[model samples]
Target: MDPNQRPDDERLSAWLDGELDSAATAEVDAWLREHPEDAARVRLWAADRDALRARLAPLADEPVPEAWHTLVRDGGRSAAPAPAPRRGLPLAWAAGLLLAGGVLGGLVGAGVVWNSPELQVALQARGWARPSPLAWTHRAAMAHAVYAPEVRHPVEVNVAQGSAAEQRAQEEHLARWLSKRLDMPVKLFDLRAHGFELVGGRLLPDAAGPSAQLMYQNSGGQRVTVYLRRPEAGADTAFRYQRDGELGLFYWTEDGFGCALVGNLPKERLLALAEAVYKQVEDGIVRTPDGGASRPDSLQPAGGRPAS
Candidate 1:
């Protein structure tokens, strides 16, 4: 906003966002010190600023491409997902779009689970009734894609901190983490039962946005990954189940997230496994490298579900 056209309150916001020149900022800062109500609003702005920084912190000071705001705000839900924003902007700008949802609400950001072409194909397969196993493969493959690339931390509970055996133990803790959110009697499918042991999982990009994924393998070493995200599209439906080709997939959205159980298996068998695994995988508990569970403290408020 032009400094000349800015209203008193707007100026205060500019000051808070650090948009004003040093002299103007100092002026607004002084005014806020004297005005209790405005000061309270400043505090709110500060909280909001911190929240947005934390939510987008992973992007490495990358510029939220012009398209990101446009995509997010205009309900960019094309079947062909938008490419992730170009990063490494000059970092000279002092202003931001500041999503109207407030910086705090950015915490509710659905992580990377819904942008992949593979996953989008899965969604289309379910609806289009084409060779469907690809959908399941889409889901599992993404889970591996998102988390395995981490540098500082991989799993929420890092058994890697201890012995090699301890690292495997982290797998067990990861299972428990899923169980906690799933709110069910959760367990890794015993190789004898499902022919797969839980290897590990990580977060990933998807058509809907960011998501969590879990990987598993069987005695014969067949593998699967479960991908999860905050639900979008027909998420309110009880469940939209699908199976195509050699892959198996079951997906659902609950609370504020979407989940897909994926594997290379037959339709009925994979559906059952997806349901059972879905029941076992947790909801809303995005685990951090430090082994603590974090939920989106900010929400989109009632009736603000972004359009597909």
Candidate 2:
């Protein structure tokens, strides 16, 4: 089906990108039959996809970056902050050179650089750097950013194809645990329709903040994570995305809730998942404030946001 000419054509494109569901996919197929021009557009999309697969499909089987070992060994910092890629598993190639030199690497790797009592002390060391200057919380987001993409050992439990009842049960456990911590109802989505399959989840401690990460895998083996927390007493925060390595992150605070989306998926797919989760949350399906009821728009955008 031509994704370019559907009523929600933009959405259709996202879906064809494997971001849509069975319902939308069928609708697109039907539409394409009626609109030959649209069909042509879909054909072009398929060709582009084929070309990309031909190019990148090989990387899928490449070694899963053995360098990831170094990061965990010394307790890597969450992806490292601004402009700095950090000294651990996900360090920049240049940093690897520094590590080889032994002079710059030892001091930073010792944990004296980034863990100083003051920012100045941490900054004094040369190898103490980041891919982006991020707040500690953002670094937490970065941690998820790095490992969630693994093809092997990506998660503890991958519930991607779990039965409906099983999925709901997992979400139920997630909600109860999260609710107790944040004093809010927590929701989990089966966004397979949106191209992410639940890959189980975990709770971790952050030097900056504690967090919950729900991992997911896509057809491309790219993994996405939804990180949640309660940052402070109460606040509604703006949603924002940060890029690390080849992946992008979408994070925001809403009604005392904190969330981050980390993945290599297209910006559109990431945003679509965020919007859907936000909607379910607002609709009382995922999380609920005292009196608010969920609506269809819960999965929709508002305030001229991209998908509105």
Candidate 3:
């Protein structure tokens, strides 16, 4: 293949991981050299990857926690399968990084699960699918990881801390602007019923296209983000869930839009919120064989079924 032919993110990522064969690696190397712009982007990715490794590297030195041993032991006994890795290091490495959390890189969040190979196997024994490498889903998780820690300016538009009417107006404006920009109906899923109120949202840049992130918070001040965008070609509408360090995510596609609800909430809590979102989204569309614009009582949430 011509080096001038641009490599997609996956190839570049593989190059970063040294996962590509020599020929492919050389091709990417040549491509990077000939295209300074591509090289710059790859360099940024390399930096981030290195930073993450460095952040988690010390964990490998600490004594493995007793909990890790127990989980790994039980994992083998239970015959649970680990989550399949999508890129870079194996899932075990990422999963190990979670259990080692304790002021390490300050990446720890609530409701995080240790997803090492054995633990993943255990999760699989319980019939859970590993989080897929769906780009938007990972982006949602990354966005949450980046902004959830902010004590100020977590979102561009904040519906909270404003008068009731102003909040409503802001909510309306957020929905309208994001919908128009992404060319999809951007319903601000009402999670107030589940103890989380809208905190407003902001436009986000996505490699696939323009995306939006809506923040929500509870009385306790815990925050979550809903990342939304139009579905890519061949995007599945399966309601999927994944836990990354402290972040828990439930993502699905509906009515031509892809959405991922991200937070550090427990799986059950996140599921309830996700279901609330699913129901609200379902309410806005009619269910018909042809998906005609009519509502039905038995409509199921997107992602092919409701997440258990």
How many clashes in each candidate?
Answer: 35, 20, 10
Report the C-alpha lDDT of model 2 over 201-225, residue by residue, as the tens digit: 7665544555677787778776778
Clashing pairs in 3: 80-121, 80-122, 81-120, 81-121, 82-121, 237-303, 238-303, 239-303, 286-294, 286-295
What order do candidates take by lDDT, descending?
3, 2, 1
Question: Which regions of candidate 2 fall more than 4 Å away from where they truly are?
Answer: 1-136, 145-158, 161-164, 207-209, 234-236, 283-308
lDDT of 1: 0.47
The full ranking of all candidates by TM-score, starting with the best, is: 3, 2, 1
Error of 3 at 25 (Å): 40
Tell me each candidate's TM-score: 0.36, 0.49, 0.55
lDDT per residue as tens, model 3, 89-151: 333443445535432122211112322355455334434443453566777776776666556
Instruction: Encode model 1's per-residue lDDT on 43-80: one tens digit a residue.
Output: 54454344344433433433556655566777866546
Cα error, residue 13 of model 1, in Å, equals 54
| Candidate scoring better on TM-score of 2 and 3 | 3
Specify the poorest-scoring 10-residue window by lDDT in model 2: 120-129
